[model samples]
Target: MSLNFNKAEFTRSAAARSGFLRDGRPQFAFAGRSNVGKSSVINRLLGRKNLAYVGASPGKTTQINYFLVDQQAYLVDLPGYGYAKVSKAEKDRWGRLMESYFQDEGGLITTGVLIVDIRHKPTADDVTMHNWFRESGCPEIVVANKLDKLKRSQVEPALELIRQTLELREEDRLVPFSAEKGAGKEELIRLLCEACGQ
Candidate 1:
């Protein structure tokens, strides 16, 4: 049976590795910089409002949220990284928690979705995440979000910058997305469905 993207439910939030789901389900982990609209992208893909908790002030939430989609696969929301205003200690803690998740022997992430703002160059943290996902040997894709903010002629250059900045190979997928206007939703859904083997 095909996976139903609409039949999603909030499963739990994992503040630490202990709280992570280990039921052997394939996990589609979405990651991004703080304020990159990671939640918005997830919500858009799911065709739901507020399913992933779009924060007014982004980067405050520091937990991994697991959402069960169609009782078949898991959409894991990793904490947004590389935002200012957070304390040094909190950042360290977040770092450790994220490291643990990546280093996990059970292979917690089946597919990695890395979201970046299309208007700016990818940050160091973003590069680190891309490397982490690559090193983990999981199927991954880079989503250039906020596509609506760019002009018609600026899109290609922006995407190329992201691709070059991330050192993405030709086989790596880079999707231009706009969470607000629902552009690129179908492509993202197709990737997710493929990841779940639906």
Candidate 2:
């Protein structure tokens, strides 16, 4: 089914598990490092400039922010991880929150989108996030964001590096995306629709 993404809007931000929405709509959780441009990717996908709160500083998203798309599925914006400036206590808090969300057997997440910088190799945090998605039994889609930073000739090699570093299955997807140029937006939306069973 085709998703009418034009109707997307900000839903709510949850700092704890108790605040998560229980309306039964499938959620595609977006996860990545603090500076991976995850929020920019979400904004680009929704065709809105600021709907997802692009942060000026790294690791600005301290909660799980939900955006309802066409009032059907939800686009869950998970807090950015791997920011070293945060205190150990804060990191532990974020870790527990993320673990609870991913470990839930009720299947709140319909899919997982792991965004990474297309210009660099995937970091250790990226690998851990990928594993969490796999352990949760949610279909994983790795998005190599910031595609505009690479030259045309460099795109293929960059994508290849991301594929190998993430150790993705042949069936898994690793899309080359550019939030600034809107490249791969349609493909990402199609995947999201497929994940949510629209």
Candidate 3:
């Protein structure tokens, strides 16, 4: 079964001391550096423009946004990290917020979808997050976003570097996705469903 993108609902933030309201339902997190199109991917998955706020600003999403799908799973949009121009103090706050979320008792992150720009390989921050996910022992699916902007031949080496840096296993899948063109959406959906145990 596919993840039914029913509606984008605002859930209570655990960092705000609201606590996790739902339990047992699996959650899939979308994480990446600032301006990596986290919001755009969510919009593309749900086929709704402005659903997740496609902003030009680097740190557009400050808080954790949760979208419940079919009341069986959650699509979590985390605030982008490693954005320039943000103060060190602010970054510290984000770090703490993320620490709390990832370590939460109810935060069963079955899959981590790491987005990366196809042209620019994985940044230092990207590698750090990739390592964190592995250390956290969560299944990860890294997607090379914005494939439409890159040359066809340039895609493989870029993805290969990410695979090597992340030490991805042979079974792990890396998809080159273009949210604008709706490419790789079906494969992503199938992966998500399998990850979420749906």
Candidate 4:
């Protein structure tokens, strides 16, 4: 049977490694910089307005949050990176937390979704996060989010720039998306289903 992502529900948030879920369910993690609309994308994917908490302040999400989809798989929301307001000590803590999660021996993550702003060139932090996903040996899907903010003619060029900047391979999936307007939501849901083996 196919999984129903519409049934996704907030499970828990883990600030430390000890708090992470360990039930052996397939996990698809979302990673991106602060203000990249990662939370908005997740909420849109789940068909909820605020399931992932669209914070007004950038870098408000400081924990690894887990949302269960139909009780079949897990949607992991990693902390947003690259916000300058945070202190160096806090940044170091975030780094350690992310490293431990990725380096986990439990094989929790099956795939990664890296979100970036569609209008701007990929930032240095974006490249670093992309490389981390690649180095983790997990298949990744890049989403150039906030697509509705661009002109129709600018879409292709913007996507191409993201593809080139991220150094995405030909086979890698780079989806142009808009959480507000629901653009590319189906494609993303299909990818999530595939990641969960649904």
Once fitted onto the true fold, the runs of candidate 3 whose alpha carbons sit more than 4 angstroms away are: 6-17
Model 4 clash tally?
Answer: 0
- Expressed as tens digits, the lDDT of each residue in 1-198 for candidate 1 is 267888899999988889989998889989998899999998988889999988888785588889999998898999899874688998888888888999899998989999999999999999999999999989898999999999989999999999899999999989999999999888888877777773
Cα lDDT, model 3, residue 7? 51
Residue-wise C-alpha lDDT for candidate 4, range 23-63, written one tens digit per residue: 98889999998999999999998999999988888898888
Superposed Cα RMSD, model 3: 1.9
Candidates sorted by lDDT, best first = 4, 1, 2, 3
User: Which sections of candidate 1 miss by over 4 Å?
Assistant: none
Superior candidate under TM-score, 1 versus 3:
1
Which one is best on lDDT? 4
Off by over 4 Å in 4: none
TM-score of the candidate numbered 4?
A: 0.96
Question: Model 2: clashing residue pairs?
Answer: none
Please write out the lDDT profile of model 3 over residues 1-198, one tens digit for every residue. Answer: 457774556564444425544577777788877888878888888778877877778887777777777667788887788774678887787787777777766656778888888778688888888877776778888988898887889888988887887778998778899888878888888898888763
- Cα deviation at 111, candidate 3, in Å, is 1.1
Tens digits of per-residue lDDT, candidate 2, 1-198, equal: 567877898889887889888788889999999999998998888888888878778888888899888888888999999964788898888898889888775778898999999999999999999999998988999999999998999999998998898888899988999999999999998988887663
